[model samples]
Target: MAYAADFYIQENIIGYTGDSQNKPTVYFRSGHKFGRITQAYPDSNYQGRSLVREYTDYSISNRPPKGTAEEYYNGEVRHCSRYPFIPVDDNDSLKAVLAIAIASYPYKKPIYSK
Candidate 1:
């Protein structure tokens, strides 16, 4: 039973993890990884944790400040002193989700719904 959850950011484009020691989340972005999604336990160093958490010895050797957004690939900023992601309203979220998906894969520009 995989529980859908939120994510964090790392300097690496393919490294986003969760929090769980026994069965940490497993993520494989574009098949770039074959291990854990949530950084494989003791490996989760959320910016939400602490400097120790972000710079934990078991995690990435170069963990940026925890304020980095997970969507950094979409021109999202890499890091900030505070939460970097913009809060989207429900209608915007639903509409944008479809638009993004279509724009990311469709053959041509799409006329977005109003």
Candidate 2:
């Protein structure tokens, strides 16, 4: 399952980290580097590290909890009655998730290399 963090790269690329806790292998995206996937875990070395992808199925025994922040955000997205970006066709999940990633970040800035 792709979380909002999966859209960190370009619109077409997904910075895929599988459904387990492994250091995300390093890669470049939009002139920045991304790899460390758990900035939220309190590693002092990860200056400017993006928080780990918090969205995951509860059934995944090894994955982190889908934190309240994401739950609330998604709740806002799904429960809100005024959402116009909710698509009605194929790739609807993709478009909706990408829309969340793109428009939700602070001033639309992405998580970049430290």
TM-score of 1: 0.21
Candidate 2 Cα lDDT to native: 0.27
* Residue-level lDDT tens digits of model 2 in 2-30: 33355354343332222112322111132
Q: Candidate 2, TM-score vs. the true structure?
A: 0.21
- Across 1-114, the per-residue lDDT of candidate 1 in tens digits comes to 111112111211232233222222222222222212222223234311111112111222222566433422223333222223232233443333322222222221112211
By how many angstroms RMSD does model 1 differ from the true structure?
17.1
Using Cα atoms with residue i matched to residue i, what is each candidate's TM-score against the true structure? 0.21, 0.21
Clashing pairs in 2: none
Each model's Cα RMSD? 17.1, 14.5
